[model samples]
Target chain A: MDPDRQSELNALRPDLLRFARLQLRDAGAAEDAVQETLLAALTGSHRFESRSSYKTWLISILRNKIVDTIRSQSRELSASSLADDDAGDDLLDDALFDRRGHWQASARPGRWGDPEASFEQQQFWNVFEACLDRLPAKTARVFMMREFLGLETEEICKETGISSSNCWVVLHRARLGLRTCLETNWFAGAGT
Target chain B: MLSCQRATELMSQEQDRPLSLAERFGLRLHVLICAGCNNYRRQMAVLRAACRRFGSLGGQ
Candidate 1:
C-alpha cells in the first residue's frame, strides 16, 4: 500500500475496532480479528482511491475474520457459550408474551414511520448501536451472522454449530429484543 | 389460527426461507386480523433493512 493509502486505512481502524468489539464482545478476539483484517488489507494487491469503498472492502474482510474467530474458539469454550445461549432464551418468553401467546400490553411493537429515513440522520445510528449493545452477546452473534454478513440459514448453522430450529429461535428473540429497544429509544420518540 | 407469538416466529423465519403452506396461510390470516402482529411484521422488515445499511455504514 502507498503511504497515502496506508494512512487512510489507519484512520479507519477505530471504526473497525469498535465494530469488531461490538460484534465479538471479547476484547482479545476482537483485537485479533481487527489485526488480521488490517494485515490482509495491507498485503492484498487491490488498489483503491475512495475511502468509502476501501472501508466497505475492509469491513467485508473483517466480517469473514470475525466469523472465523468466533468459529475457531476452543471446543470447550464454544460449548460453554452455546449452553449460555440456550439458557438465555427461557428468560425471554414470559417477559415478551402471556399464556395466550399475545404480546404483553406494553411490549407490542410500536408505530415507527419510515425506518429507512433514519439512515440519513447520523444520530439514529448511535441509537441503533446502543440497541444492538443491549442484546446478549451470543444472540447478537447469531443475528450478525444472518443479517450483517447476509448468510443463509444453512451457512449460519454450519458456522455457528447450531441446528436450524435453534438458529430461528435465536433470530426471533434477537429481533424482538432489538425492535423493542429501538422503539423505546429512537423510533417511538415524539419527533424522531 | 396462529397466535401473535407464532405469527412473529414465522415472520422472522421468512427472512431465511420460504414458509410452509400452513405457516404462510396461518400467519397471513393472523396478521391480517391482528394489529399487533402486523406491526411486528413491519418492524421485522425495518430491522432487516437497518442491518443491511448498518453493516455497510458502520465502518465509517
Candidate 2:
C-alpha cells in the first residue's frame, strides 16, 4: 500500500474498533474484525468510486464485518455468551423506580439543559460514550443495535435471543441509564 | 390514568413498537399534564437523533 493510504487506514482503526466493540463486546473479536476490514479495504482500493468520503467507505466495510461477527456468534454452539442469563428484571425496576411506580429521586431523568448544544461539541460524544460504557454489556449492545445499526426491534430480539417485551425492557433500561449517566457525568457536571 | 413511571415506560416502548390505543391515550394524557414526562419524551427524541447523527459520523 502507498504510505499515505496506509497512514489513513491506520488512523481509522480506533473508530472502527470502537464501533465493533460496541456491537460485539469482545475485544479479540473486534480486533479481528478491524484487521479484516483493513485488509479488505487494501485489496479493494481499486474499487473505490469516490461517491463517498474514504472514511465513510471504510466504515461501511467495518459495519458489514461487525454484522458478520454477530451472525457467527449467534450460530456457534455455546459461544461463551457474555450476558448473564439470570439478569433479573427486578434489578432495574427496584433501582430506578419506587413501589408507587415513580422514578426514584436519584434515578429520574433531569432536564439536560441544552442537550442540542452539546451535540455540536465533539467533547460531548466522549462523555456520551463514557456513559455508554457504564451500562451493562447486553443492555448497551441492544440499545446500539436499535439506535445505531437502525435494526428493527424484531431483528434485535432474534439476534439476541430475547423476547420482544424483554427487548423493550432492555431498551427502556438503557435509555434510563444513559439519560442518568449523561446527566450526572456530562450535563450536570458541566453545570448545564 | 397513567402514572409518571407508566407514561415513561410507554414512551420508551413506543420507539420500538406501536402502542395500543389505551397506551396511546394514557401517554398523551400523562404527558399533557406532566411536564416531566413531556421532557422525558423530548429527551428520548434527542437521544435517538444524536445516535443517528453519530452513526453517520462514523467516529462514534
DockQ of each: 0.71, 0.61
- Candidate 2 per-residue C-alpha lDDT over A1-192 given as tens digits, one digit per residue, 9 for 90 to 100: 777778888776787888787778789999999999999989984645553478777877787787778877764212134245226447766876799887687776667777667888878888788878878777777788888778898887777777788788778878877876777777777645
CA lDDT, candidate 2, residue A87: 62
Question: Which lDDT value does model 1 have at A155?
Answer: 82
Candidate 1, CAPRI quality class derived from DockQ: medium
Best model per DockQ:
1
Residue lDDT tens for model 1, A147-175 = 88788988877776777887887888889
lDDT (CA) per prediction: 0.81, 0.77
For all predictions, the C-alpha RMSD in Å is 2.4, 3.2
Chain A TM-score per candidate?
0.85, 0.80
Residues B13-36, candidate 1: write the lDDT tens digits: 998889889888888899888888
> Which runs of model 1 end up more than 4 angstroms from their true locations?
A74-91, B58-60
